[model samples]
Target: MEKKPNDVPKPNKENTISLEIAKDWTKRWRDMESTYNSHHDCRAFNIPLIDLQEVIKEQGVVSVRGYIGVEETVVEGDTVFIEKLIIVGVDANGKDMISSKDGLILDQESDDIYDFSDPCPNLCDPKSPLNG
Candidate 1:
């Protein structure tokens, strides 16, 4: 006899724990981004952090993009975790400016690309003339 799909055991505990951790981290990350955006003179510019829960619910995958700083990665078991994503913001003159921690993270499975590279030189520098 074949078991029904609903008979399969669901990893509820694991999923719940992962969701909680993701929520906590997302809040902290957004707070940090808000502070950085405020001081960088990009009041009009916005880089909304993508909601992983929503993405997972809608697309069954965690994919997001925005101005985040730095790109650090770590491998745990078979999964690779990327962090410190920096989003680009506009300068006082409404020109795009890249964060000092700009980098890229490409998800092969999802075909999602997170690009934070500074197209203009020294945009993250405080003393850079382009900052104006």
Candidate 2:
């Protein structure tokens, strides 16, 4: 007959107690912050900290272009994830002219070709820059 009992060591409560406490604390904190607060949207640096290459790849843009289309690219809710580098061209007037899988223009200050991490954080509205 094969031996069945006393082979495996029983888990000790001492090792797991702190881990359980930590988990419970984390859950309680999450619950405490669950209420709606205006400050949630004010987190300025909402960007993820990662390598530029990975960011670009995640955005599905091989290269950046100065323009999003014939008109200058404007920032909208749509173009939030594009990498800032890879813009290719710009029109005679100051406007981005290429379209990436991500969205409108990536960088704003730069008309020259270079890599950037963030897209146009602030863009003038193409429809009416003055009114909007």
Candidate 3:
């Protein structure tokens, strides 16, 4: 079947059955591996489940704390790092959102000159279109 863009597949009875079978097989494999490793002292390394959970929790806390306000912009030299560029309406809904361009301009005073006297063929001319 041809899938359209943004199409979501609906689950059926066959899919549910296959998913259950896969889960059962995975669990059995894990149990067998654990048993074999326990007696043989296998070199396979695995972090404890509790430790993994704690690490995940710490990561979530750090991510939440790292969030900056929408108006905040951190700049080092000529480089700018905008936290978030969003226009909010009076009702607290987002009107528009913009993202910063990425690239390190090594030399801003380079002698290279781009002639923009004619209208840009890419429709990205910064000058007023009505004037032209």
- What is residue 17's positional error in candidate 3, in angstroms? 7.8
Which whole-number lDDT from 0 to 100 does residue 118 have in model 1?
38
Clashes of each: 9, 14, 0
lDDT scores of the candidates, listed in order: 0.33, 0.29, 0.24
Regions of model 1 farther than 4 Å from truth: 1-29, 38-108, 119-121, 124-131
Please write out the lDDT profile of model 1 over residues 1-132, one tens digit for every residue.
Answer: 343232222353221212222333345556666465444433222223342332234333333334433222334534222233332233345543322222222223322222323322223445556555
What are the TM-scores, per candidate, against the unseen true structure?
Answer: 0.23, 0.15, 0.16
Best by TM-score: 1
lDDT per residue for candidate 2 within 4-42, as digits (tens), equals: 222111353211112222223234434444441222221
Q: What is the lDDT of residue 97 in candidate 1?
A: 33
| Candidate 2 wrong stretches, greater than 4 Å | 1-17, 36-132
Q: For candidate 2, what is the lDDT? A: 0.29
Over 1-132, each residue of candidate 3 has an lDDT whose tens digit, in order, gives: 232221221243111112222223334445555454344322212233543333224311221111111111234534221111111111113211111133222123211111111112223333656425
Q: Report the lDDT of model 2 for residue 41.
A: 22
